[model samples]
Target: MMRRRLLYWITALGLGTLILASTGYAQTLSQQVLNLLARTNTWTADQTFDNLTITGVCTGCGGAGGGTVTSVAMTVAPAAIFDIGGTPIVGAGTLALSLDTQANNLAFMGPNGGGPSVPA
Candidate 1:
């Protein structure tokens, strides 16, 4: 329910901004969209992990562990607003994504695992 509500709000906010821009209140709709994207700090998302391997590394300690077949959580942040040459590009926004965690979100894992304890 919470996830649904959050998604609804995000969609509503985006759509509302687009509508405002489209109605010629200020800037172009496309530019407004770009500005919105460029202004967001970070957005996170959850995803399934199927046949994917994650690697862990410890510098100086020379310890590493990695495996395959698990779950994945992802977070993305806005990249540098300016270009490599220190020039601010017009209407350019990009996201830098990082896979935060790996585990399973299946029915067998119970409610904590992301699924119901029993089949619904």
Candidate 2:
């Protein structure tokens, strides 16, 4: 009986470790934007991404430029929802985004009428 209990405990511990190890963590929207900016200052061609949500304050999501001009243009297809600072901005279709770091500005051009300009 003692040997059987020890074996059961070992098996349980091994399974638990395996399950935890198999789990994966995904990066947040803000983190993804920052990573892209780190790679390049400007995005020449228009980029597209899946539905994303921005939670906390997103600093530097507007690209990065000290004194020079920097910009990024991308499209969020299907649907794009932004929940930041408790404010929710929801949109459908293709959501076009233009970011100018020098001006600390972010513009959104969605389907139908044009979108709003958000300060970064």
Q: What is the lDDT of candidate 2?
A: 0.31
lDDT of 2 at 68: 37
Q: Where in model 2 is the C-alpha error above 4 Å?
A: 1-23, 29-38, 43-120
Cα lDDT tens digits for candidate 1, 24-74: 332224544443454543322221123211121111232478665333332
Q: How well does each candidate superpose onto the true structure, as a TM-score?
A: 0.12, 0.12
Q: In candidate 2, how many Å is residue 109 off? A: 81
TM-score of 2: 0.12
The RMSD (Cα, Å) of candidate 2 is: 26.7
